[model samples]
Target: MSLTLAARTQHMTSSAIREILKLTERPGVLSLAGGLPSPDSFPLDALAQASERVWRTQGAQAMQYANSEGLMPLRDWIARRVSLPHWQVEPEQVLVTTGSQQGLDLLGKVLLDPGSEVLVEQPTYLGALQAFSAYEPAYRPWLADAQGPDPQALQPRNAMNESVRAAYLVPSFQNPTGHAIDADRRAAIAAALRAHRVTLIEDNPYGELWYDAPPPAPIAASAPHQTVYLGSLSKVLAPGLRIGYVVTPPDEAPGALALRARLLQAKQASDLHTPGFNQRLVLQLLADGFDLDAHVVSVRQRYKAQRDAMAQALTRHLPEGCIWQIPQGGMFFWVQGPDGFDAAASLPDAVEQGVAYVPGSAFYVDATLASRQQMRLSFVTLSVAQIHDAVVRLAEHLRREGRRSC
Candidate 1:
């Protein structure tokens, strides 16, 4: 007889990106698949020096179990860094998380009631959808246009069975699409959330990787009382450190205070705390005078070159009917092929031909509405030459499928 399983266990599924990364490891394959930061950009020297300092001066303390709310100094630093001139975020408002991913899990646990509505972009971050699915919230797509998801449409309507609990978005350098919400849209979205009284989960892991000017201030700045802001060190520093923070609204609001307390309880249940050593190591890194801004400048330079190469390669190699909007910043190129070209179904052929990308369908809440012709390709993991060659190979394969002219 088969062993019994919890009903909630059925909700979990493997990450498609992780499954695809395994295929990418086969010999001779060039993958534009994983949304990973370039290893070449990691500040190894700074990390090592910081680790050594953590061991040398605060050895015992670093190994000791930390608080569920995270290290005070680390939280303080994050609060100050994210605070804008108009919006002041105090250390009491910050909670250090295992990663921004954990912050998503914690938010879902504390905020969502099964069947509650959660508004999302047309093609949102797949990880977020995965994280929130365990809580079983109903997703309603925020209608999007040339500018971005319209704020007015995101407001509550007579159609929903239940009240909208929250709206989640990657407003800066959005995952999959790589589209940053402009300042005007940010204000409009913030206003709408306030008007409708729906909470906002502002996930922004890629905001700092901007190739040109910084994206606008977070939507949280506009509707401070209504947003749960998330930020991560993974893209800017190193993913192995696995450090991120969640900023709840100011403490003066009792609702925000209660939400923060419940979230800490959820976090304590989840991991006790983010590893003590990791927290100290990051603090030590800051104390050692690591210039994060300068480091990010170097990272942006490398990624910009890669982004440029992929844009050029796609323009030169892909068929006439294929289309893509050159991303202004961030890691991916969201490409759309002609009608009748199914990106998800073409995966086996793409893999066999030695090139790989993530089909866009995995990002949508209603998989039926996902564009069959669309795909997301990440450029940071491959060299310029590799990107050029891989696009040529993919274009050749598309030619065989009747997508290319010659």
Candidate 2:
């Protein structure tokens, strides 16, 4: 007799970044491979103070099981934070998820059928793809330009073949490619979404980490009725907290109301709501005047310096044929190696030279020859001096491989 497993398990693969990270642990290797925020940015002392208050005053409720919708005060704060002058989010519409990653999984669970077509950016967030894969939805590549995915793709030319159930995108400082969707494009996409039958899943984890200015209002802001918005505290706050939320479309609409119930149900089935003590810890911090806006300002300033160091290092070190986009706001610099240079093929040699970066091929659903030429470098986790040194080492390795101009 033999045991069998679900067929969907075949689509699940180990994370490419985690596989590369193991190489960084070796002696003297510099990693620009992880999109981790500097630990220096966290307000540990303030958090300690908040934790003390939570334990002393609210320990019972904080440790007790909570409602699936989450703590009321936390939900109220999230609703107010996400609301704009034109659009208002109700507290009941906010579903506290373990992490934004869990929100993606819940959306996949509730909205996707085995064969449903879901539109996604050409090289989208790999985590979202992974979360959606377990449910077995068909992946369709989103056609995009410099600004973002073309608004025209929001509606298929002949959707009669199969309706596109939803489109997923990272509109602000997207992973693997640091391109942010501009205001004009957001409006165009919003207008297109208004005409289309598809729902929009807007996942924005890096919106608050902007270097120059805040990104345009979320695409959901333009068409709140049609978009299910997701946001996270990992970038601005500590990622270890694992706090994130989902803002469902207005409850007044019949479809949105139904979706909200299913989402809450999925969330309850997932973890019975995010850890109550953790939620209380964050609430205590906020109530104690944590000044989240000012905290983000400091984080932006620190990451900006690191971003500058990476930009300068790349210009001074990388071969003439190599190209990279200097991200204005996010943690990554998406670099394209010289013509015919395969980033994955060169990773072993680069690690041997004491440097590492994530190969870009894993980020694409429809990877091609062009995709193999790219890689993503994370500047946030390393110091400015380390970033410059890593770029120099990576360049030396590229030269040795005969992929760089002398």
lDDT of each: 0.89, 0.89
lDDT tens per residue, model 2, 1-406: 8989889898787888988989899999999998788999999999999999999999999889988887899999999988999888999889988879999999999999998889999788889999999999888888887778988887666746445889999999999789999999999989988887579999999988899878999998898888999999998999999999999998765499899989988888888879999999999999999999999899999999999999999999998779888887889999988776778988988999999999999888886623777899999988999998999999898777773423
Worst 10 residues of 2 by lDDT: 154-163
Clashing pairs in 2: none
CA deviation > 4 Å runs, candidate 2: 159-162, 403-406
Runs in model 1 lying further than 4 Å from the true structure:
159-162, 403-406
**CA-only RMSD, every prediction:** 1.9, 1.6
